[model samples]
Target: MPLAEIPLCVWRKRGQDFVFQGQAIRYWVAGQGEPLLLIHGFPTASWDWHYLWQPLAQRYRVIACDMLGFGDSAKPLNHAYSLLEQADLQQALLAHLGVDQPLHLLAHDYGDSVAQELLARHYEAGVEIASCVFLNGGLFPETHRPVLTQKLLLSPLGWMIGRAFSREGLVKSFRQIFGPHTRPSESELDDFWSLIDSHHGPRIMHKLIGYIPERRVQRERWVSAMQRGDIALRVIDGEVDPISGGHMVERYRQLIPSPDTVLLPGIGHYPQIEAPMQVLTHYLTFRDDLVSPPRKAACS
Candidate 1:
């Protein structure tokens, strides 16, 4: 599918739009071969894939979109942001692009929730997904350890906390989850703050964070998606993350059959950003295994 030009053009830097339910969200598509969809975490835009985008594009038709209410997309204050809607948005984007072929998914954090929802839908008659690769995320709500700030934001007075949210608070929260050796630098933190500065904090954060609790309510559907063997699965995680670190990986091994996992010891949350090359290696290895011919026994 053409990445641009119906009413707007799509570019790596100046991305174009795809309207979903009348809301225009930014999306980027590049390269060729089977499609590979990238879904980013909460409070961060699709720019999270910048580190690995070009390299990945070399092998597959890489597609990424800034979900509604995130990035440069229209973040209406009245918008009802939920993982269900986000999953629907992804399916719609593929359909709009006329992608009938089985595609792949690479998702992180909140995007994990969206991916799980899509995986559940995979058992139905719809867009066929070849496989999925997960980064650090709360696949199991029981294991997720939201920081104090996140907990406060989900509280009754979250609006008040949101009003008081500051860059310092964000920095502190980020540093907490990130590995001690891999903290966000000033410039990087600035870019992150800028993206969410307006939409982040305030009631917008409160609304967006609703996904945390929703995870609990729909825990069965999502967690079960992982166990169903519906699609090939791989998890590349930052083991040190206080949120869903190595512990989550252990849980996955216990639940998923013959789980495929890559554990980055020093990395924290944001593996693609912190350890781009490593994440790329593990991801490509997994995808390659999917298409490669199985090795046969030597002739006697």
Candidate 2:
């Protein structure tokens, strides 16, 4: 594929490499300041942040990695792709980099689950964390509405279905989740498929999709971490996403005390991609508010 045709060409050139637990991990680091670790959702790599990478890197020390079984990372057929292990890998990655500064987290889809485990660790083992921002994901299993492809991928014939998946299938599936009006462009679809095709991603998608079920099993611990409310947390979602959009936000507001959220009315699941400026503005506002919270008036 021509570099001009695939946007990932530049992202590939700019990214650095790391080895985690004997597995090759693709991660990127840029800028300087407080560390902001980005965890991308399933079926896509850290490239998901490509839209917001430079602007974010301009301010914060940004770290993003392609988790195991996704993107440029090695996708092993034997390993069980679980969120717990993914969280462990993230911690190890930061630790390996000697990132001791208080860290902020930005996660989407599967990354959200891993972030939840990290949040739990903050309470359990005292990992320094300042805040966490969640994108559209199956955070609550009940609220997650997987499209037909995902359901089929999780079925008994999942492995077969995943292996036989095609580019047309990918486009069809994405169209369902993304807002009707904000559908992915041809180039965007090309990038997504190309990334998935890297390292036999399609072959192992079933294993990765298992996170949905894993979320239900570990619900007690992960959900408790959110309910604990120890650190600053916020949610930015695309309201039209069929999977985890407005519906998920409603559930979040109901569950988390004093919830802070932003809903992009016409947007869908991938808010960062669909509306980078909007997501960036809202995200910066959330980060800024943390630094200088609005003060209350003194009693007369």
Candidate 3:
């Protein structure tokens, strides 16, 4: 589907109300049954899940929203979009959705960081998590090597750089996220650019990058909690993604015992866009595994 063809206006108009840290949030809700919340990464909005949503929604209550500053959601300049704040916002959104039972979480890029904070908070509150599917990001800042653009955006002078850049520069920056097998079509690129062209795009971009917390002692604590037997964590990684490929998977494996990892060859950072089929397959298999009966113990 083309970007221009997307019913973003209609979706925004129909969004349900939610409160995030004293601010109101607008989110899209569709389907029914076990809840499945999909969170997008930087620059883009919930539209990132456009392809995967329909199929997934057929069997799950799909919820995808534009994180505070992105898409048609409320963009409050007063609030700093920190990871902690985003997590709290997601928590409030869930409460508004009446999602009290354990549910699956699908997160990519920065969304993973937000999920980490939510999972940590839930664990502390003794809440149950059915499963978590992490794609392309694990929030291990110590191990992450940000690209030059990332560094620029996260720096103090990000606002100037973002405001001064051209459309070609924006396209070039986005190209870095794809793999050799997947070059985003012109329409897709235009859609991304349009979203970034939205109000306070540059400022929001800067805050998004700047707000990521540095890896600290808490990393070990969160990793330990995620490793607990009760939580089923799986990772779907794009092999060609320089940002969070093999090394990130290795780190996750070392920290979390028996994490189900799938490597997609010839695909890069955005697996949902580059390799949607692979992503969908992995998600379905993981979901089935969670619902399926466990193998009987071997007889003595």
Candidate 4:
């Protein structure tokens, strides 16, 4: 399977679009219905949803974008890829698309951080949020254990490593992130590498880590916002994920009362890629549960 032939059936390269900040933002949109925004994590493009797009697009308006410094999106070296900046860009993208309606947010990894910031702002503004589905990722920095690569990238040594990122290194990093999951097929690995091989790719990697602030300061606020009951929240965690394991799930449940949490055994971090069918099924179940008619009050 050559990298080009990996079958990105759902996401098409729709090209660039002008928004408030600049024209550097690029995104792909597919399907139709209540808007469903899929935000990818650090070091990966919207292609993270390659396996997830088609099935999800079939039922909902799926929009996946390369964050400012990643994928086809323009990378401005001078700009800071902070969480607040990313959230603002995402909001602008949605507003540009005329998706004023409440949205269902599906995010993983660093995306979870960005989405948290976005939802927090929205919650403060009293905006409607259809639902939020968080996959394997560290939402709270305090609870997050940074991997060796993450620690290096956030350190002064990051520039050197960023500059040294090679195809070999990229593949190795991908494998490490996948942890116990079977090695991605050569072609799949190549596809991921090619995307990161783009200009300033390594530099963007460095910036992404800097984007997340110390979570201790904001953790309680995020937890409180999610528990507000007005917004529906659920989590689908990869049981074996090294970065965000069952411990993170317990923390989430503790903070957000009655959070719907699903543990996928045998799956690692990237559930969307590793278990597309299962991920889709859970998403559909969540969606249906939302629209299902509430049972009449039990006879008093």
Clashes of each: 0, 0, 0, 0
Tens-digit lDDT track of model 3 for 1-300: 321233445445666766666655657788888988898887677777777877787899998777878766666665666776677677777777788888689999878877776678767883446778888874686667666777887778887776665558667776786797697887777677666666656555666675455435457666666777577777888877888877887787677665678888777788888888788888888788776764221110
Model 4 worst lDDT window (10 residues): 1-10
Off by over 4 Å in 4: 1-12, 214-217, 293-300
Tens digit per residue, CA lDDT, model 4, 1-300: 211222543243454566547646768788989899999987777888877776787899998788878876777666666766777778888888888888889999888887787678877883456889999888766667667777788788887877777778866666665637645788777677767766667766776678556455667777667777776677888777777867788777677766688888777778888777777778778787887853121100
Higher-scoring candidate on lDDT, 2 or 3? 2
Cα lDDT listed for each candidate: 0.82, 0.86, 0.73, 0.74
Residue-level lDDT tens digits of model 1 in 1-300: 212111111233568798999988888888999999999998778877877887888999988898988876767787778999998899888988887889799999999998888887877555577899999999999889998988998999887887687778879899888888878788778777766764443447778889999899888877787788747899999999989999998898888876888889999999888888888888878887777754221110
* Angstrom error at residue 94, model 1: 1.2
Better of 1 and 4 by lDDT: 1
Q: Is candidate 3 or candidate 4 better by lDDT?
A: 4
Q: Could you give candidate 2's per-residue lDDT for residues 4-65 as a string of tens digits?
A: 12268888998777888889998889899999999999788898888888888889999999
Regions of model 2 farther than 4 Å from truth: 1-6, 294-300
Using all chains and alpha carbons, the TM-scores for the candidates as numbered come to 0.91, 0.94, 0.88, 0.90
Q: lDDT: which is higher, 2 or 4? A: 2
Score candidate 2 by lDDT: 0.86
Q: Give stretches of model 3 more than 4 Å off.
A: 1-19, 22-24, 214-218, 293-300
Cα displacement (Å) at residue 144, model 1: 0.5
Candidate 1 global lDDT:
0.82
